[model samples]
Target: MSDRPDDTPAPRDADELNEAVSDLGETDTDRLEAVRGRNESLEERLPGDEQLPRTHGSPEKG
Candidate 1:
C-alpha cells in the first residue's frame, strides 16, 4: 500500500558525471572572453584609459 510517487528525476550516474567533467575541461575560452570584456569596461571608467604613467628612474639598468 505504498503511495509514494516515483516521478522524481534520476540522480546523475557515472556516465553523466564523466561527461560533465569533460564539458568543464573545454570551457576556458568562454571564461577568458568574459574576463577580457570586464577588463576593457573597467579601463574605460578609470581616469587614464590608455596606460598608467611610467615611473622615472624607478627601475634603472633598463
Candidate 2:
C-alpha cells in the first residue's frame, strides 16, 4: 500500500540520501503541475458567482 515502489532500494550514505531527496523534490514539481491543471479544470466547471460563496471586504485587508 506504499506510494513508493517495492523495488526501490534505501540510501545507505549521506550523499546517497541527499541525492534521493533531491530527486524526490524534482519529481514533486511534475506532480504539482498536474494538480494545478486539475484544479483549473474543476474551477471552470463550477457554477456562476450567484451560486458560489461571497466575500466581504478586501481579502488583503485582513
The numbered model that scores best in TM-score is 2
Q: Clashes in model 1: which pairs? A: none
Model 2 misplaced stretches (Cα beyond 4 Å): 1-26, 50-62
For model 2, residues 1-62, the per-residue Cα lDDT tens digits are 87888889764898775565573346868656766888899999999987866677555544
Per-residue alpha-carbon lDDT of candidate 1 for residues 1-62, written as tens digits (9 for 90 to 100): 54656886677999897675564345767656766888899977887733666566465555
Steric collisions counted per model = 0, 0
Q: Which 10-residue window of candidate 2 scores lowest in summed lDDT?
A: 17-26
lDDT over C-alpha atoms for residue 17 of model 2: 59
List ranges where model 1 is wrong by over 4 Å: 1-26, 49-62
Against the true structure, candidate 2 has what lDDT? 0.72
Q: How much lDDT does each candidate structure score?
A: 0.68, 0.72
Candidate 1 Cα lDDT to native: 0.68
